[model samples]
Target: MHEPAHARVPAQPLIPAQQKVLRHSVRGQVLDALRAALVDGDLAPGEIYSGPALGERFGVSATPVREAMQQLALEGAVECLPNRGFRVLTRTARELAELAEVRALLEVPVMLRLARTVPVSAFESLRPAAAATAGAAAAGDLPRYADADRSFHGQVLALAGNDQLVQVAEELHRRAQWPLPGAARIRRADLIADAAEHSALLEALIARDLPVVESLVREHFAGNPA
Candidate 1:
């Protein structure tokens, strides 16, 4: 069956499952890179990026980059420009405020409920995630800080034992973090202050201080601008 050495298949070939896994791995890596670029302002708002160009930048095929851009479009981070490409959207303060309101409506009550019933040990366990945000902020690493921030919140909400709620809340959280055009750059001091609130909220949760938790939660959402 080996008509020519050059035409012969490799001794070990990737199975269908393995191929799918490899594809997913590449797609995930591309997606993370795109998200990091967005957070770092490397992909500026209102910029138009084609899949091929992004693929060249990330050293992958256009497929994964386009897939990642599609996901970003679904998350409201970008707008699909028909046959052209994707345009990074500039988030408005009003849009961000609306998102904050929705997140507050969903999470505040759940957090308060969990504070009253969940064990203090559960809150204690999330301290490391909370601390990670502070470290990321200290380094002025916005992408890392964003990830740590989301992880900290996700961990806190996962205590409710509702996967659907966690997914929806996280989606909203990501949308709120998108960059705004003409807005002042986020200062490291501001990031540090915001990161500190995570620990403060955790402390209130551990203490079972309902009023303090509610106040902190509301203020946290209010102070955040998109």
Candidate 2:
């Protein structure tokens, strides 16, 4: 028999050094996308996210997708499966109720301090973000509206004059987004109503009505969500 021809081998694909940087960038992008999906309710609680499918969706390899899922798991946004995959973490209705209660307690009192300390000038500064929220509500961009809604709260928090309270509220607001999907639609009416409240709070502040501001803050959270 004729000697077999030497087997030809294909050269290995070379990933350049810059590929590592690209991989990191891809990982970051994947992280942000998954986070947004979670916040927007596109990734529902208890739903499985396939690493391969996520990789395909973002036009990346599974490595970055897996990495992003792991990070989200650490944040409690998702949970890892044993030898299977990851699933979105669910917050029970009871847990949501408790969070709402805590938010009311922490944030409303903080707003009381802010309403008292916020200058009339700061009210003018808040108008634009407030307007953006109103516009988003009109346009039916619930996520943008949520952002604007949160921004309005942030402006109030900033005026509280307590750096630590502001920081804690800011962080809690981020986590709060997870439970806000259903509330987003409810907030269409809420934003309009809240705009009025914000205006009223400012007016009360200008008038130095501490009781009125406290009442408004309490009312705001009390009616937030069940």
Candidate 3:
């Protein structure tokens, strides 16, 4: 992603309180936090990130920081430099479009099949994911909203019983998450509409309406119908 015109480093980097380590939080938890930070724009795209600095922010040693970043690199979220650290990598517009196409091809089929096969009762447990998405959207919390978006979609796809499929779909989803042009200027209406779609999609699924489910899935990419 291109740097925003007004981009400037903050006066102070985030420093998580050491006392906040409540109960030996694992590396996965740290990874989740870092991922959320990226989605929330707490970590700017195109910025260089050092493991030690991030370690300080997370109140942990550099090892876990590096490890977590390594995982992100594998997922194409960041690129590591030998002597330096990692650079956040956002897909170009064309690249994101291609990914969206591929994602729709893969995601839509599974969704359609599940709509016809899975009982509506099986989806009752997914209410929380949908609710979280609505809550995040209503509050305009991008990180929380993005994570909930993933949860709702992932849960929907899990009926396929393919862990690898979910992982790949998630990678593509993350790539499409870079801030749009004038991201800070995004309107409340857009966010509300985006969040509301989750509930609509869920209702479509529960109703076993394959056609509506397919359309909703395609529109999840927003204006890029597959």
Estimate TM-scores for all models: 0.88, 0.70, 0.82
**Highest TM-score scorer:** 1
- Summarize candidate 1's per-residue lDDT along 137-216 as a digit string, tens digits: 99988889889888999999999999999999999988888777766668899899999999999999999999999999
Model 2, residue 144: displacement in angstroms? 1.7
| lDDT value, residue 62 of candidate 3 | 73
lDDT for 225 in candidate 1 is 31
Clashing pairs in 2: none
Candidate 3 residue lDDT tens string, 1-226: 5422213322232335445553335467667777876665666667778777777666677777788889888877778987678887755668777877998999989999888888887777788888887887788777777788887888888888999999988888876776543346345466678878888988998999989999998888755211
Residue runs of model 1 more than 4 Å from their true location after superposition: 1-21
- Could you arrange the candidates by lDDT from highest to lowest? 1, 3, 2
Task: Write candidate 2's Cα lDDT for 9-51 as tens digits.
Answer: 1112223334555777778867866765665666767666667
Candidate 2 error regions (>4 Å): 1-28, 161-164, 179-208, 222-226
**Most lDDT-accurate candidate:** 1
lDDT head-to-head 2 vs 3, winner: 3
Alpha carbon lDDT of residue 217, candidate 3? Answer: 82
Model 1 clashes, total count: 0
Model 1 lowest lDDT segment of ten: 2-11
